[model samples]
Target: MTALTKNNPFAASVYVYDEEEYARMQMLVTEDVTAGVALKGDEVVSVFAHQDGAHPGVAQSMLRQATALGGRRLDCFDTVLPKLYADAGFVPVARLTWNDDYAPDGWNYETYRRYNNGRPDVVFMAYDPSAVGSLYERGAGKYVTDYDDGIAKTQAYQAASVGN
Candidate 1:
């Protein structure tokens, strides 16, 4: 395991774990069995950061660490903040949806289901860590703002549909 620290109080630590260990750690955070399955070899690296640590600095740090470790790709299951991943050069490749019965704590499954008219959506993203530096240099702030806007929109939509 490798740890990256930032000055931000919210983002105290970001850890990049070896494939086998990462896989084991993921088991406790999610029901997705394939979280790091594609990153089993040395070509890809798996990373973890607390939801509160989902800031640009942490993301950039992780990207750099992954690149330094000789990772060709980086894979992670970001339950929220797809746009942040998008900014880091990660693209959404898959979406996993779960019913209310299986939804994780703090996730408003009913709202998500209502937004999709009964389909909840969770995003899985991938990216080449090597390309992230250039991407970040281009317009990192824009991506973070866009992600925040998306969250705000979702919250507004859900709040509006509270009693419907």
Candidate 2:
């Protein structure tokens, strides 16, 4: 529900959304989701953008600032957005379903993803706290790995670091 008019190292502008609007989007989709805008000083550097399509650019921009701000993880339905997150070096963790009766398909998961709408799919992705820098510096090894596989790869890396 937010839009980013500008974004850069120095400044950015982002449209803000209230809880009511947020709820409406969820109600229409009837899925678990969250989104917002980013700002640096008084400028709107980037808006979280839409979850529907072509979000790689926006997700990367959002990831840049979100990581800088110590963002833990983002939760959203399995949609184009998660792919953008994965492309940004984040990994998919687990898929979950909502128990509400109004939820279609009983919020059941499809293909290890809870957001697959049959027409279009959605997925949730998680990013490592340290993968915020330039992709090359961090190594695209992790980025290329699927969300599920990344968990094991990261664990191995952690173990190796500890062994050293």
Candidate 3:
């Protein structure tokens, strides 16, 4: 899993598993599984395809599995990730990207995205499923505010751009 996403700036942050879940998360995977979809609560933190000697669609397949497994939200940094998730019933909220003055963020070989600001973030896109209602419903769309959890917990917008 790390090998596929090593080029990502957030590679260090992708390790979102809590101690207990880390030991057992693999039990949830089956023989046919070939991709990695890291989750935090109901959100998917990371998705990586084992592109080394593997077939296409590994990442897409895992994303579908994530939704089926109850992922409610996720932040996608890959250029295509936004579109892929949009087609899967998710609604785009914030589209952030690093400024042109700075280099774009992405795997070394990837092309710079058209727009981005979500961190790791050369061009980040965050999505939430309509079923959960959107930030607009919660009155947060006005400012694209970070969640107000008030304590040691995950914030919606914070976790929405990157993993744990």
> Best-fitting candidate, measured by TM-score?
3
For each candidate in turn, the TM-score is 0.37, 0.39, 0.51
- Model 1, residue pairs in steric clash: none
Q: Candidate 2, overall lDDT?
A: 0.39
Residues 1-164, candidate 1: write the lDDT tens digits. Answer: 22222332322112344556655432222232212212334333344444343253454455444434443333222333444555655544344443455443344334444335434344434454333533222122212223335344334433443435
Residue 47 of model 3, lDDT score: 61
What does candidate 3 score on TM?
A: 0.51
* Model 2: lDDT of residue 154: 42
Q: Which is superior by lDDT, 1 or 2?
A: 2
Can you give the lDDT of residue 76 in candidate 2?
38
lDDT of 2 by residue, 46-162 (tens): 235444544434556556555465443443344444555565555554434432332333233343242333222223344564453423211123232244454454445445545
Ranking by lDDT: 3, 2, 1
Ten contiguous residues minimizing lDDT sum, candidate 3? 134-143
Candidate numbers sorted by TM-score from highest down: 3, 2, 1
Candidate 1 Cα misplacement greater than 4 A, ranges: 1-56, 67-80, 106-120, 129-164
**By the lDDT metric, which is better: model 1 or model 3?**
3
Q: Is candidate 2 or candidate 3 better by lDDT?
A: 3
RMSD of 2: 12.5
Error of 2 at 117 (Å): 4.2
